[model samples]
Target: MQEASAINKEHDKPPQITRGFWLTALLILMFIANPLTAFAYFTSPDVIVSVHPKATIGIVYFFGVMSTINFAIAVGIWCWKKWAVYGMYLSVAIAFVINIYLGVGILGALFGLVGGLVIFLTTRNRWQWFN
Candidate 1:
């Protein structure tokens, strides 16, 4: 009986960990916002170009592509994939650089990274739960 129990324990999966309320909320917001922003960029390039005339259509399209990738990252996060956190950081850094290039100013570019900080804070404690 002891041998059988030991074998069963070895095969048992670990208990599933919940993402908790704040993380869940953050992921949900990311899911909604990223796609809508991507859609807007894709459907109306003029919206961004009108504001930042210095920005080319290529830049606008790049933002749209980044938004799409962000949405995918959010999905990966929802699935508890560790790579998503790194991707989120990378995306934010890219946006910051692009914002600066588009003349958004350093302050505005820094402000854009707030979401990344929030995401890090929300996920920091739950790192062990992520794969």
Candidate 2:
């Protein structure tokens, strides 16, 4: 009876994550790294300024905000929470808008497109884990 119960418990676990989930997970990791990249930028603005000295203090603050937003979104995604998917989409949109104002929106738009796809695939599977 104990053996049968144990087998039942094993079967109750969620199905194995697919290859698409792995790719989506990788993207989530990248999203989580945003803060670290922002920190690096904050510490060494010279590198950025050298490329374009016009980069201002405001830009640093913008990166800081983006870092916080990305971190929160990453956490939500990690927990497979439903709100995280919406948060990810919102962040992508904000990123593109900011980049557009800065005259380099294309990369952010690209990220949004790819990240949207990843989020869709990931959430479709793990969404059941959320409330």
Candidate 1 on 1-131: residue-level lDDT in tens? 99999989988968668887877887898899989999999999998899998898899999999989999999999988989999999999999999999999999999999878987988898899889
User: Which residues of candidate 2, in runs, are more than 4 Å off?
Assistant: 1-20, 49-55, 105-108
10 residues in a row with least lDDT, candidate 1: 13-22
Q: Model 2, 50: alpha-carbon shift in Å?
A: 4.6
List the RMSD of every prediction in angstroms: 4.0, 4.2
lDDT of 2 at 104: 59
Q: What lDDT is obtained when candidate 1 is compared to the true structure?
A: 0.91
Candidate 2's displacement at residue 45, Å, is 3.5
Clashing pairs in 1: none
Residue 24 of model 1: what lDDT? 85
